[model samples]
Target chain A: MEPGMISLAGGNPDLAGLPLDALGDAASALIREHGTEVLQYSTGAGIDELRTELTRVMARAGIEADPADLLVTAGSQMALELITAMYCDPGDVVLAEGPSYVGAISTFMGLEAEVSHVPCDADGIVPDALEARIAELRAAGKRVKLLYTIPNFNNPSGITLAADRRPRIAEICREAGIVLVEDDPYGLVRFEGETVPAIRAADPSVIYLGSLSKIFSPGIRIGWVLAPREVRDRLQLLSESTTIHASTLSQHLALTYLRDFDWSGHLDRAIVRYRERAEALLEALPSALPAGSTWTRPSGGFFVWATLPEGASADELFALAAEEGVVFIPGSGFYADGQGERELRFSFSLESPERIREGMTRLARASERYARR
Target chain B: MEPGMISLAGGNPDLAGLPLDALGDAASALIREHGTEVLQYSTGAGIDELRTELTRVMARAGIEADPADLLVTAGSQMALELITAMYCDPGDVVLAEGPSYVGAISTFMGLEAEVSHVPCDADGIVPDALEARIAELRAAGKRVKLLYTIPNFNNPSGITLAADRRPRIAEICREAGIVLVEDDPYGLVRFEGETVPAIRAADPSVIYLGSLSKIFSPGIRIGWVLAPREVRDRLQLLSESTTIHASTLSQHLALTYLRDFDWSGHLDRAIVRYRERAEALLEALPSALPAGSTWTRPSGGFFVWATLPEGASADELFALAAEEGVVFIPGSGFYADGQGERELRFSFSLESPERIREGMTRLARASERYARR
Candidate 1:
């Protein structure tokens, strides 16, 4: 980016409050003590200790996962890819939110799987709408094999799947024989909301993806999948064949961080900062966006999804925002069918509260200039 | 394995001679100094400095790689998978050596691609046979998309393609319109032998895979592919969609290892240890195996591929060896068609010289017992 540009485009985690120096010392100690094993190729299923620890991490999210059923992946992104590759054939329909995680959408596209969007409300995927979409696809003779969902604090749109709707969606998919993939990267990163029990907590068959990227560190690239016995078997083979396993060094570092460090304390402190930044963006959105424009007010997670006033183009606004020396993702990039032309996704994760406020001010000027034009 | 059992199955690098303490300090200092950047997500193409350093690494193997044409992958295993996914459709034939890397074969099978074996001799893949096999497959109206070759010290076979045949094989593949994937994880791990130019050096169309796993550390899981521009773009997209990127910390660690450390010096010391282990295994094999049994005398890398005497069952030998407290990979596992019932692979990279000799003694007793049975 050019100098002085305030980027609201990337959803990268804030690294300022992390225990970098201490973690560095821990990294040194781990490698020094366990260099031989950590530096060697591990079992294709992943190291036993990391998987055992991951069960505790999942337990905190209200899901009881067996270490035997868990497979450590490069990230939850890889888990998504593995599931899609294993189940979705070419032209197989995968149902996801209308505006879903761009990375998940790209994974489906890369594997030649057809993605169909299920409409979502503020509380997340409406149960009836999800059922209706599945039925419609079945009626069209399309095989709906998977329902990909970001159940908690979804990317681009920080809407959480309401706790009441969780089991309902899981049941709908179970009855429909469609695999339900609950991606919960931000489930544990909540600031003020009551903890929502994962859909997987009620359904054993649901494949749950959990990541430490939001809470611990993404640089380590550790994420895992908890699946049914048979699916876990297939995923292990897929993971072994492709990347063999996630980086052993990264996994060991994560293990050391989780094992020895005050990880929860670090996360609590980071959440405070994230909440403050979210408030700054939410506070600015009302006056910054034009009248009739609307946006999500997330209690936690990274983004606020804002829709431009009817007939205003987010694409044009994006260009104007660039000239104003700020940047954000145009919402169309998040959709499979380019239907979010008048929408924008503003991320508050990377910037400080002050920078976010200044960025919003610049965005307001750009919006006014766009409206005038 | 049970206590006292010798394992010659794993092709793990010997970490005994590695600078563990210094590396630990380096890891600490690197994370301390560059925590924020190293702890964040990197570009899909990988960090620029790592790729730039990779060119120098590849240059040592006589391949001039443009950083623009390189995509950093989790391992060469991933590079093979991406190429297979990009080019090979289901039922498309991928030609590989008769005894090939098990990981590569598994990758092809996982993606539903058909693997066809081209018969190999001690000098590695015979150019004439490779051409003949392609001609026969073409005549049979099969779609042959790729030729996967481990040109430098093959995993199970311990064979390197003769320098003179490299260009010929490249030409044949080019004429056959096949993508030649040169997987050279062990290229830089050479203990002795003239440095043969990579097939990719002669033909830029060939996709060259290089890994730091064999030379630096597999724990970090860093590898790269130098492909033609179009293929590199596809690989970058494939990589981005799945793992998103290799671990940022691992990449930064690799960059630091290359930039600040005498990595070549470390490899030299590792080579000495490897040479000692290989020599021990080779010396023991002559007296350990029955007369008429033969094995390749590898100049570098891991493994010594041995063919049991006529009518001997390596599977039976393996069982006996297990009882006698030793383990080896049966050769059939390395073959696509299950044609190597009377062969075995003994990896010398993991065990010390003393352990390798003891393991060979146990293997000889097993062989004699199997022959008696």
Candidate 2:
């Protein structure tokens, strides 16, 4: 174990690779050009320019949308919160993948909604299992309010839903009259494979969530939700009641960057950097793991989820790894039904290849010590 | 009818008065000095530097609070929404002044909480009426969950609560175990008289809301909630579910502005400007308004609430005013129940004294036209 820990715990992008100069220039230029208009309150829908750009951002995923169909939020998290506030009452059931983003689960729980995990496979949530769960929840007289999924490069899993199944998933949700919330914060971070059609492409009524957190800067906290008119109006009201609007200066900064910078070229550079980090961790894993240990080989995105030996507790491993100066998320935190006890999630988002290699070596040593215990 | 209309309907600050150059410099300096750290995700409590600065900002109000006791929110609007979400359940009662801020009533209603207006006089919500309303609500088996008030320089009323009555309001809430949300966005913008003590001074447990929007800029969306440890933690969770944190870049910009700018001098100038505008509106009112129309003589803040002649309709006057090329909020919009029909709220925040005089003349013409109808 190394004395200084290499944390693979957070899903934060590497600041070294970010377009810092461009962001700074954008903010400065916006304030200079617009004067105090950049410093005033915004319409709850956010600044018009940013929302127009967001439609273009969404169009990249093959989802056709207009500015009127979208509402700017504090981040994609607020988009999720607002959707729940708009649709679900307390005790309403929210079906999500068994192993998913912990933050979303926490958000639903905070809203007093009951989150029930549907079974998931290597290619997102299993369709048949999802359909069965919906029927079971309905049979019990529970209101199935929403079906939330990160169809592309899902957090913790780093797995994208197979493109062929996108329509089926949407159909299932629509048939049940449950709104499907497609949270796609990490979709644009793909290092390999062609861009898959968004679930919103399959169903235009889908509340599609998008963010600049992965590609641009999370500090700006700019994210948008594209939905039907009625849903979009409620989302705007939620923004009004909560944030009023995302920071007006942040929105203008986003607008300036979109208008003036080559974001696509910047994204290409980010992809190259992340792809290298992912490969380094993937290559080191086999040498580090004990027999029967297995992990996903992601083609894109931040995480590489690993399954430990049967009956091995990820919580116990997390404690030991921290003492040994290496850190990752214990996968139990992502599940609503106390599953994922023998799994861990490692993120290669912020770390360099050299740092990831050292962190994996430390993880290997920690596993050996725990196995002996 | 005048050819050029003047808008007194909005609550937006004057662009000419905003510290654009200083704000721009602050933003540029922050990004230049900190690099991408200013462009990253934040903890739910927000950045420490901003919260520390916020504590210093609050100290001027006689609030001796630690940064740990404060949670930085997207804005004071987010603070109000979080308080309602945290304390109230469906069907819970939220009591406020008869003519309070419209935004807040919408927020409580959006959360499915019933908003009821407590009786009010010029000196804000009458303490005796407040205590009686709480008792009445409790007697009816209703949960009197929150007492939401703007303690000084209220939004629609433009009236500060009497100094002696502040303690009584807090005591009433404390005895009933109801949360008191002290929304003080415009308190620090006082252009005349002494700064009154906060209702939070009488009870430290009060969830006091403060914003930089009134004295600084709203574009940054910087606001903070000062509460007890348990309440602060819950507010952080709500922040987590909503905006994640106030924009990290905005936080740094605010910190830089606080650290380097001559804020006291800036505020002094703002006070002087606002006082002139307020006086202009007051001076013009007698000649511009019809007989038996009375208005508040607020010592500070943006609003001047006026009552029209008996049975006069503010909405009817509003329609005529729009036709005559002048505008103000019909007081009906401010009340939770259908009341305040013969009242109007005129803001002196956005226009100059010269423009205000012309607008008042237009309003006078509108009133005469409506009276004949």
After superposition, the stretches of candidate 1 with alpha carbons farther than 4 Å from their true spots are none
Instruction: Give per-model TM-scores.
Output: 0.99, 0.98
**What would the TM-score be for candidate 2 when compared with the true structure?**
0.98
Q: Residue A356 deviation, candidate 1, in Å?
A: 0.9
Model 1 lDDT tens row, B1-373: 6889899998888887777888899889878888888888888998999999999998988888889999999887888888888998889999999899899988888778889999788788888888889989989999999999999889889999999889999999999899899999888878897888888887999999999898988878899999999989989999988888999999988998888889999899999999999999999998788678999988899988999888988888889999999998989989878889999999999888999899888988987887688
Off by over 4 Å in 2: A1-3, B1-3
Fill in the DockQ of model 1. Answer: 0.85
User: Residue B84: error of model 1 in Å?
Assistant: 0.4
Q: The CA-based lDDT of model 1 is what?
A: 0.89
Predicted candidate 2 versus true structure: per-residue lDDT over B244-285, tens digit per residue: 888998888888777778777787788888889899999998
Model 2 docking grade: medium
Pick by TM-score: which candidate is best? Answer: 1
Angstrom error of the Cα, residue B236, model 1: value is 0.3
* Candidate 2: tens digits of C-alpha lDDT, residues A295-361: 8878788999999888888888888878877799999899877899998899998888999998888
